[model samples]
Target: MPASSHHYRRTVLLLWLAAAVLLGLTWWHVFALVSQSRAKELANAERDLANLTRVSQEHANRTFRGADQVIRFIQSRYLELGNTLDLKALTLQGVIDAEIFPQVGVIDAMGIYTLSNQPITGKLDLSDREHFKVHVTSTSDALFVSQPVLGRATGKWSIQLTRRINRPNGDFAGVVVVSVDPGYFTRFYKELRLGQRGMMALYGLDGVARALNVGSREEFGRQANNSPVFARIAAGEEEGHYTARSVVDNVDQMVHFRKLPGYSLMIAAGLDTQSVLGNHNAAKEALWLQAAIVSMLVLALATALTRHLRQIGTEMNTRQRAQRQIEERNAQLNAIFDLSPDGFVSFDNKKRVNYISPAFRQMTGMGNETLEGVDENDFSIWLAWRCATSTPFLGVAALRADLAGGKPDPRVLIELNQRGKRVLQLGLRSSKSSSVSQILYLRDVTHEAEVDQMKSEFLATAAHELRTPMASILGYAEVLLNEEFNAATQHEFLNTIYVQSKLMANILNELLDLARIEARRDRDFRYTRVDLQMLVTDLAHTYPVPAGRSGLELTLPEQPLYLMADSGKLRQTLLNVISNAFKYSPHGDPVELKAWIKSTPNRAPGVCIEITDHGIGMSPAQLARVGERFYRADTSGKIPGTGLGMSIVKEIVALHHGTIEIDSAPGLGTTVRLCLPTYATLQDSVDQDGPSRSKLDHAIQDTRPAALS
Candidate 1:
């Protein structure tokens, strides 16, 4: 009986030891996982802060750079035109972005506020201002960024960006000052949606804040020399991040900062530590709860080991089921990866390709190639070869080197010369799983790139078109301001200014009209039955026939050709077509305007208005791009036209459920056919498909105007 008791005591002792060991190991695992998760969370927050800092730095740089450009331009103009620079006219002409720099002025050598975009009520002395004093003391051509101060001219808080104006003889003439609104930066930061406790700031290297936002509170001109960032900057670091207590609010934050290139300013973004780690704390709590439950289970198992040794079998079965569930979950994840539109690739811990999703294979056009087990170097080379030859992957070596150093840019853009031209945004990230060390994601961004490119081109074209007339107006006005002339000469100059002003107004009006039409489509149109014959006759009678050009030869069908359209818009379209006809033709060339009823198979009956012009006809290439905005065949600048008339005409015609066809050849006459749905046919369509459907069909059909040579 004693021996039995000893053995039982030994068994219990052994069970207790096993339970203690299990509990200890389980808790260790939980702590380790929690620590790792905390580190990852902090790391991700730092990365996000870094990205935001970079963006903010870029924004600040652009703002300062643009301000510098404006200052330099004004400085040059002030020196060239002296006091006759006319800042008000420049502002009106959009040479100055008035909304951004509300007060742009010139302070003369004697400290007098000589000129400004804003009206100067009386002589204002600006010599005592830091921006003015700095330029007055030094002849440095570098742009000076000053601390936030109340502008005497603007009557508001602004940052003064100044440049020295030098005369032709190298004398300091004055300072050109541009007042930038500090609220601009803060307004943009608000859009970033940083956490409630987040912060974004712009500080000069000299330790003064240009603009700073902490939570919802904003401060300017606050000294920050005591901040840790200055110490790092003193150590020659251009950019860095760290976790520290804020000097302003005493809140601990994960802060990332970047120094704006070619400027003395730096931008910093911070995420509140508490806010960033809130989720991590929650996860840790759940893990600890799980650990507690596991410990209780271990103790219970130790206590019941003798009576329920069979419980071990049940535990094994449960583990098996759990393993099966894990496998099924993995399969589901695999299916999701397969069906995802974005491409993904995983690299094993050894930096060799382990798996590539089907989408990745198809995206890279390497579906047939065996890529598994390929090392990073070989994979980079293969990928580089697939990229466009014109823009070869020159960064492959650098990217590989960065990866080897365990740091790489998070994102890159690669253009591929594959099935068709494609632009893919590639993102790299570390994987959490033990088997996979890294993950690469690829997303198609061709459409976005194209859109950005088109927008840039449109802005550039519009600017160029507007600048020409502006230059003329500014030049003539400057002449009038700077020099005295005879009555005839003055009248000629005034007339030139008037003509250029009219041209600018015309361009602006047309641009607004085009924008309105594109945005609202036909929603703003007041539709009604309109007489096409009457519209044509009225247009020809009131049309301003250019010098050496005859009136339009108008013809109409016996029956009044009617259209279900906006009469005003229809009249504008006809006028634009007729104007273009006269503008492009030779002397005495008659613009033939003919109207008749027309019908095509499988289409509604319509009225066709044909306008024929016989001089300087376009080539097939030019004709193909006739309706494109700002596309003028006459690049020699001899022609006086905005090149938007045809575009407007096409838009108006399409809105009226019509089609435009252009037939032309180089050195030959051109015929433009505008076919509009007749009132009856439109009424029938409205009865059958509803007005909206009919409009949709018309829009789809008229998306591209037909051109023939």
Candidate 2:
């Protein structure tokens, strides 16, 4: 082989060896992690199974113990009744007369049905019943439970409990049986759950599942004397697990079984294996996906490495023959670096600055001749400058590091004041060559900050000035209305003053409210349970008097409603709406106040208060801009008021955690609707403290609203 081909073969071999080693290491690490994770999951599953088994056994014991106690209590009562048979019959007769007989009927030791307080009367054969049969056959005086059977007298599905009795000669004489309606068992297991897709059933001594198995009644009377579960129980096992197909859904399930304490019955709770192992199946799928990805990545990386080695081999073979070409290429690269707009530098492993272009010094505000001997690691001067100027250079360093790790980050815009009042934006990058150096380009952005500052200062001054006079005017009007004055002389003047004052106040408040909201300050919330009906009635009474004075009618509902909300805020919202109605409508136009609860689909219950006025209503275009601060519908200035009532209403409603909607027509009428949540109690209305009084209101002139004359 030629010398070049020999070197090429050696390079290929090294690449292959490295790829193989890396692939094996990666596979081992991933496999070990997956295996350890799966083992922990399996252990946790086994522990959960053990806990479930213990819980099921305890539940079964409690149920059986309760049943046993009920049987014993009935047996003792029956024995006592036997001694006073006459009195027992009298009480049974009285119960039947009263038409509230007991659910169960008791029998005496003589096998005679002494008391049948139930409405269904019949002489029944005690020997034929399973409860009586179990009692008579047993040698001991133990409580015996029988298989579920149809009662011959009532024809209802029932289970029976019985007590054995003996005659004076010590020979078995008869039995006392207490019939239990199977409905009791149905109710007992109705709420019991094994899992999302699991159910429970009770099994008897005869291997037959009982009525407790919900919705499997057809198989009740069928013989089940040879089930695997019953066979194990008969072998004296207290508990076991069996894989069986459920009769209800015909799905295979793992049934956990427990024998009831001192009872022949057993509880079988089943969980579908597919359902129980859902999360495990999901995890396994994820692992398989990861393994496939790992294999593909390994193949891709190996191919890339092979290609890279081939390229390096080609370069090495031509190195001796192209010495002049390599020098020329290096000169061209140096020229490009020096002429570039951004800072550029190359550092060797020892952290010494190997190469830096003029652009680097220019961008960093450094002298060009002094950079060559400087250590790149000693960058504290640059960091300190960044901190002093509040320039975002530390973030630039982090951004460059992230870019090196194959992350896509945006060019950062930094504000820097380096030796002048100029701001700079830096664009940083790490070379793809895997060399230990970073590149950066920076520019200025001082004009943007000046523009933003102008906007903030304008809003603050304008809002403060407008609000001061508005509060003074509104507050004085309120004081005049509240004081006892000469009614005939000053009423009209005061009313006019109040109306104009309200309009001015609303404009000022909206401007201030919007300004504060834009500043993102904390909102004030007050909770109070207001009788919604009372509020509506008061508003209606006020609206009609004003409307009547202007030759108009006001309509309202005749009932009371209640809701939880900030009353002051709600009043402000209402005042704006009522003011709007009076302002836009022609004198004598009817206004309607309606309050009702709206039941919204897929939303919380809402209480709505609506004000409607019939006058020269607004166009759709005007209504759309109604909530904009200082937004005027009619610029003709014929309307003698500031156009901020609706806007203030919108803000106040928002502060009260309510929503407002407007409906209007050019020639018909306008309606405003406010929906708020109904407070269930006083606690629901307010936060931990009661309604908070506004400190801002105290600082400003008190703008108390005047009551309607």
Candidate 3:
């Protein structure tokens, strides 16, 4: 057998041995606990039974003695008046109570008749009564208590108590009897609350139950001569306990009995065994339940250990397989990390560099030098030098303060010149899952920042443009209100006011159009088919040319070239281009418009329109920004043109999936080109790059577009 299998068997045996030992100990504990519980319960029950017995006897003594005392008082009256006793008058005067003693009378020697507390209607004799027979047999001073019997006078079941009545010669005369209701003793005992199936019984010296209250019933005429419980008390036992069933109710119980000290009566209290030991049994059952639960937990732990041991070999094999796969992929990940375009670097909470990307190296001009030992202070020195050598808009001190300040903006943009003009956006992000606390990144945003600057300049230029026209309108209106002029001069001033007011209104309307189209949230354009030949011919004929300045020339293809576009916006775009051509050209130069259909590689067949002006044109620098909002080539307030016209033209062409081109120089002229797709579906004009390119190109291509110039 293999050593591994032998080891497995040994380990399994050890686990089971441990479990068996633990189970044995648990069972021992449970048995000891249960035994202790049983002993305590028995001791408590015996003590409680003794207390109950004492209480029952005291209750029986007080009631019986009270009745005996009443009988003695009645006997004194009988001895006084011999045969002519007025028992009815004594009872009527509240001297003798019929409720306590239902019948108090005396029997003659012949046992023929009797005198009672209440008058008897019929002939009631007492010669056969147990109390009368006892006195005739023994002429003693002791009271004879008999078992419950129906009274001859009252006809109610009662315990008969009699004392001997002797004549002057000391012979047996008769018996003075008292009928004691047994309910008083039984009801008193019932209040003692001996638990379920309890009893309080009174037994005579003759071993007969005189007054008994057993399980809620009162009865008599029962003999206890053969009872083991009674035999104990009869054989000179003072007090004792035994387990037996009641003779009156037959309920199984533990009976506790005590003989009255000076009387021949014995009172016993019995309680069901279940009531006495039920709590102890419950504690034993709870111990058993705990043992069962511990056993289940042990078995479950064993099963888990076995399963874990079996999986060890498989897990080892899996770990080796995963290690090889990680090794194979490590090189590819490193290559990507070095080549990423965005600069990346990490720093710990103490400002130690954890990692630095190659792009970050190039940006900081640390050519081919390893950054492994570089700390944040080293990078800070490099950053300080870069800020000094480059643009100083926000100085090195300001940038350094933010880096070391209590708190700083997470992202900050800096305008600088490195290899070329550049805008570096620096940002910090937290990394929680490493020793490194922060990662700092830098991205080149030169083109975006320059465009943003141009927009800002454009906004200022627009405000100036709007205010210039308002100033003219307000000047002419104030002059007209105050100064008197000839009819022709006033008319000229009014014309100037009208033209300036119209210029302001047109600028405001154009700004509104730009805002609506750029929103892109809803349908911005109503698409329709347009005929280029008709559009160009109409624009040429009704051209807004100055009277003695220029000619509007049209060069259109004879065949109608139709394109799918928003006609209203397209018309506005074309008119803006034409108007700018006339507005910017030298006073007598001709503004020419031409249109034709042209097709390009990977693009749909589209209409091309070129507006060329033979005027003093823009420099290369000015031409670059000609398509910006509110940008103007002429800033001297000489040319009658708002810079927004070309930008609007560019936006409208781009919306129709078209492009704009401008070719110009410092002193020559400028030509604007628009190449638009013809009436085909919008998707036909879209360009999708195939897989025949670098992966980076597919992800984020930096392409510079030129219109058909």
Q: What is the lDDT of residue 457 in candidate 1?
A: 92
Give the per-residue lDDT of model 1 (tens digit) for 381-456: 8888889877566443454456667543346788998889888878776655789988778887777777678788
Model 2 lDDT per residue over 1-709, tens place: 8999999999888877877775666556446645654554444444444445455456555544545554455455455445343323434545222122123455555455654434446666566566766665677767776677887766776666666765556667466555655555544555554455565666677766664443333234434465577778878888777667766566676677777776777766666667666665675566556555655665667755445444434653464355433221000000001123555565544444566667556655677455454554455245345433455456544665667675433365555456655455555544545454555455444455554575566456556546755666666577676876677646765666666566655555556555554444224545555666666556655654553445223344333344556676677677777767776775667666777666555555567777888877789788777875556666675766555567667766665567888888987888888887653222233334442234222322322221111
lDDT of 3: 0.71
What is the lDDT, from 0 to 100, of the residue 700 in candidate 3?
Answer: 23
**lDDT winner:** 1
Tell how far residue 393 is off in model 3, in angstroms. Answer: 99
Residue pairs in steric clash, candidate 1?
none
Q: List the candidate 2 regions with Cα displacement exceeding 4 Å.
A: 1-60, 83-102, 107-117, 168-173, 181-190, 211-227, 234-236, 240-250, 302-709
TM-score of 3: 0.41
> Please, what is the whole-model Cα lDDT of each candidate in the order they appear?
0.79, 0.57, 0.71
lDDT of 1 at 641: 84
Ranking by TM-score: 1, 3, 2
TM-score of each: 0.46, 0.36, 0.41
